[model samples]
Target: MRRIITVEEHFDFPDSQTIPEQTEPENDAHVNPKGNDPALVTTLLANFDQKLAYMDQYGISLQVLSDPNAVASTITDKQKAVASAQRTNDHLAQKIAQYPGRFAGLAVLPLIDPEAAAEELHRSVTELGFKGALIGGVPFGHFLDEPQYLPIFEAAEKLEVPIYLHPGMPSKAQRELLYESPSYSDSLAGMLGSAGWGWHAEQGVQMIRLIAAGIFDRFPNLHLVSGHWGEMVPNFLERLDEFIGKIPTPLERKFSDYYRQNVFVTASGMFTKPQMQLAVTEMGADHVLWAEDFPFLRRKQQVTDFLEAADLTDKQKDQIAFQNSQKLFGLAK
Candidate 1:
């Protein structure tokens, strides 16, 4: 089996009082049925031993862990958010230290205050030895394309670390407008709004917003990691480029060009050949990373089986499995 480095793997701070109510056990089941397993949540919270065993069982060499709850992003109070983020990062850093070669960390930032978030990101990379920051969904109801969030992106570019853009639950207005339906149960609507469909759609829109706002133009070297096969963006890049060209904008490059240049995508729990082929075709093997979205989707055999059965050359498979991640995250070989 090829060495594997999964980047989208998640963990959470133990006794994290800041976890959003929506992420509580009862509601989480509705949002993501995969998370209904209490054992999964236990593993996500602090069961490092089980995580390591699972990795060993599946031949995974390393996992870059981040907070799945995205507590910092959901906390409304600035002070609380900042404190919670620091505490969470410190907790994760300690955990990574415990398992030396088996794990790396991604910082969770308090994006409520952009400047403070930037400072925390710098501290996380320099002091805590984290690989990068992971921003979960639309923080503070902002799409991250706004000027207020530029500091976080600027910090990432300056630090030469990629930011992982993980999906978050949609906001109230979004849910009411796009996901609510009298024809279906709330659970179905909740699922549809989240991991089922809306999550990917919203993430794709956010990426486009960043490009349209000239974020990449400003920070030309900024790197972003998007999971779930570019959040469904890569599949529609050609159409986006074609239509976006007709709209007048000051973008320095085509929509597709920005995506190709500044983004690295991961196969986070998406093991199908067609999506993998499309991602490799659109983003190139060098720009693709491997991930399992662990604890959420524990089908380790499916991931390994699909990867081994993939049609790509050995080198390309290696790149997706570990080489790309090592190069991007500066992981030790």
Candidate 2:
């Protein structure tokens, strides 16, 4: 059996005490305090470590995303935030260093300036010994499809590394765009609940932007993978194709053609046999990878059970289960 490499998963940076308590107190209705409870991703990792040690149970290891640092939080100064990201990346790299087979690092580029982001990408890959770059699906209201940020894409292409577009908070002042819906309701749960809802929706829009902006045309070799099973875009791909075809554009091709060409999707939290089947339907087994969002949910057994029960050929199961990710991450063995 081939080893697996799970990309497109994230771990948020821990906040220093000096950052001040920016969290809004809950209505007592909300259990977790905003800005203070810490992101669940890393908490999951810590739990995973405990389980592995005591339970004698293990599953595939993850190349956890260490980007998407609190740079999005308003309290963070861009320069200071980038410095913090550097510190976190260095720390994460060391952790990976301790267990070479168990972990790998991803860089959090300073995104306020595109040129700086490009330079960081070069440093992360060229100097820090990291695998690839992780950018928020929409960086500061600028989608990855924007031409101004071509240098980042160009550098990733030049280095032939994957770009993991993990979801994060959109730029401030952009909140109004999300204000029109029920997602806009105030209160921590309602506000963040709505925003969490917005994350997947916004990501789907970003994927469409990538297609419409001809980004794939310029960087054909670039590998772009999304979390949460392409963030629900697969279910609506047909409508996307129809809209694009009717818009009087010169580029006439199936939307799936572009999707299958440049995109890969990970089955992280929403993994089940039927949904995993839907993921394969659009992305194919080669482009879809299995994942267990450890700790926050249950351990590796949930994922193992799904894989064991999936109705796929042994070879197909092998690809989705492990082989494809190894090939995608250049861990082909």
Candidate 3:
């Protein structure tokens, strides 16, 4: 059974270290990698507070967050890195506990090392009682699909916690490949372009690797969710199946089967009706959930449009809003 889940969201650290203001030129090849301008974030959080209060008029619950400043450079080493991540999550968990009605929390993880991430996951869930982890779109130096990070996936499998892949500026190597001229063009790719594309491409690529590499097959219960209706799953299911079937040799199982069993996606930034229908048809109503990019103050249109657009049964709508999340958080049946 699916229930309602409204994910109140916030972003990880932004492009450069300048919080709330731009010190240098916006150009110069994107100094602040994450694009979360601090001054902007502060103003937005205030707006988020107002919006959260306003949502009550419409009967929505806000799932709050204390995401780590995932700007890789900011959180550099051991003492400053892991401990700060834990402290932030611990604080957010405390906040959520205070307003149990309007809250559930996601941990912003520092995935510098696999063991470090494993330790933090345990602490966030067992001690501080976080709902799950939110990883930036790409790990600092590696893509989520890279085989080097299997131990991290193994840990999530053991913990039975979901990880949300929020967007971030892409790694240097990634930006170089997609655009014709990194020297002339920008990684920002017009501000929000590459981050959006990266999330979509990265999720699809990683999910394929997880399925193809036999990670999901090995850890059947490991729950993974990404932002933007899984980027491409909604529209590309048939093509994925067809390609896999046509080239089925090394892969042990059908491509469609893995998606049906292992993946979940959120309505965090996607606000289109066509996309909503495609997501429901491919991923199933139960597999899709809602997320409000809280501190960004993205706007109310997504909230209203998603509620109206999804081809959800009443039970499914309930799940997308609340219960689906409950299950992911170990809070539901």
Candidate 4:
């Protein structure tokens, strides 16, 4: 069997730092009231040893762990956000130290302050030895394309680290316009505005916003990683190029060119062959990475089965399974 390196696995902040009210429903079965899967909650809160057992069972060799909630980004208070981010990264680094070869870390930045965020990214990489950073969603209702956030991108480029853009909860206006309705239950509406559709769509739009705002042109060598099969971007690249391509811009390359050059995508629990094929076809094998979105999708058999069954050559499979991540994050074999 090939060595598997999964990127997109997540860990939450220690309970002391977590605010119960702000915690998302998906992470708690009791709060969700709809998807009441206690097993998932258990898995999410599982210990490092427990996580390793599951990974061992599933043939996952190394997991690049991150904070799923992007906790610091959502914190409105600057001091609290910075402190939380430091605490979170410190906790993750301590955990990674315990199991040296079994785990790697992606820092969670306090994007509430872009300058502070850059400094934290630098600290996490230089001091904690984290592979990269993960920015969950729009902070303060602003996309990363905004000028205020340029420091974060610039820091990332200088550090030679990638930022994993993960899905975040939608805002109130978004819910009302696209998901909320009198016809549906609150839970159903919430689902519609979250994982079911909204999250992926929002992430896809953020990617476009970054491109249109000239983020790539400014920081040409900046690297980014997107989850959930490129947040639906891979499937729509041609359509994006077709429509956005004609728009006048100061971009040096086509919209798709930036994607191919600067972005990498991971499976992030979407394990079907068709999705895998689409990502590979659009992004190439070298640009793809494997991820199980652990704790949420804890099907040991399914993870191993999908990669084994996929119609890919040995080299291609190796690249997707681990090589791509090793190259991207400087992971050891």
Against the unseen true structure, what C-alpha lDDT does each candidate score?
Answer: 0.85, 0.63, 0.62, 0.83
Q: Evaluate model 2: give its TM-score.
A: 0.80
Model 4 bad stretches (over 4 Å) = 15-35, 39-43
Sorting all predicted structures by TM-score, with the top scorer first, yields 1, 4, 2, 3
For 1-333, candidate 4 gives per-residue lDDT tens digits of 889889988787754765633533232121241135855655554488889888888788999999857567667678888888898899989989999799999998887789999999999999999999998867667888889999999999999999999887767678768887899787777777887888888888898899888898999989999998899888888888898767877888888999988999999988987889999999999999999888766657777778878999989988998899998998887
- Taking every candidate in turn, the Cα RMSD to the unseen true structure, in Å, is 2.3, 4.5, 4.9, 2.6
Clash number for every model? 0, 0, 23, 0
Residue 326, candidate 2: alpha-carbon lDDT: 71
- Give per-residue CA lDDT, model 1, range 1-333, as digits (tens): 678889999886743566553321223336643466867666555788889989999888999998856667666678888888898888888878889899999988887789999999999999999989898777756799999999999999999999999887777567768987999988888888888887788888888899889999999999999999999899889998999899888987898999998899998888888999999999999999999888777877876777888999999988988999998998999
- Candidate 1's TM-score reads 0.94
List runs of model 3 lying over 4 Å from the truth. Answer: 1-4, 11-40, 46-51, 64-76, 180-188, 192-196, 248-250, 301-305, 309-311
Tens-digit lDDT track of model 3 for 189-234: 5333354465467556756666667766667788777667776765
Collision pairs in model 4: none
lDDT measured at residue 258 in model 4 versus the true structure, 0 to 100: 94
Better-scoring candidate (lDDT), 1 or 4: 1
User: What is the lDDT ranking, best to worst?
Assistant: 1, 4, 2, 3
Instruction: Point out where model 1 deviates above 4 Å.
Output: 14-29, 32-34
Question: Candidates' TM-scores?
Answer: 0.94, 0.80, 0.80, 0.93
Error of 2 at 111 (Å): 0.8
